[model samples]
Target: MMTLEEFKEKNYGKRGNTERDELEAGYENFKIGALIHDTRLEMGMTRHNLQKK
Candidate 1:
């Protein structure tokens, strides 16, 4: 298997545009999860407390 450097070099080409583009497409769910997690922390809420609003 290629090292991460080699893999990134192969898939991301010179400027990392391909991998960055792919990551951009998948970033929304992560953003939402982080927002929810941060809000829960701010509100002192547990995962159990936040279920199904």
Candidate 2:
């Protein structure tokens, strides 16, 4: 099987391409959201609790 980088290159074009850049930005946003979610869970904060703060 191809690596993730190779798969991205084959399906999305090189890093500088507009589609690739947008995909990368989306992935970064997802990563940030995941990190925040995990942190909130670790802190024993539910969504409602977080919203209160």
Candidate 3:
């Protein structure tokens, strides 16, 4: 898990700081969602099953 501070430092660029931060945040969330999806598949669970639980 990356803290916001770490992300900020790693993503800092010459311009578009705000846009880059937002993009990084979105990418991080997407990564987390992908991990969750992969874990469910590994456990032989469908999205429907996860939603019902």
Would you estimate the TM-scores of all the predictions? 0.54, 0.94, 0.68
lDDT of 2: 0.97
The sequence of per-residue lDDT tens digits that candidate 2 reaches over residues 1-53 is 99999999999999999999999999999999999999999999999999999
**After TM-score superposition, what is the CA distance of residue 17 in candidate 1 from its true location, in Å?**
8.9
> Which candidate do you rate higher for lDDT, 1 or 2?
2
lDDT of 3 by residue, 23-53 (tens): 7789899999999999999999999999999
Considering TM-score, which of the candidate structures 1 and 2 is the better prediction for this target?
Answer: 2
Better of 1 and 3 by TM-score: 3
* Ordering by TM-score: 2, 3, 1
* Highest TM-score scorer: 2
Worst 10 residues of 3 by lDDT: 7-16
Model 1 has a clash total of 0
Candidate 3 runs further than 4 Å off = 1-16
Tens digit of lDDT per residue, candidate 1, span 17-41? 8775675556777899999999999
TM-score of 1: 0.54
User: Which of 2 and 3 is the better model by TM-score?
Assistant: 2
Query: What does candidate 3 score on TM?
Result: 0.68
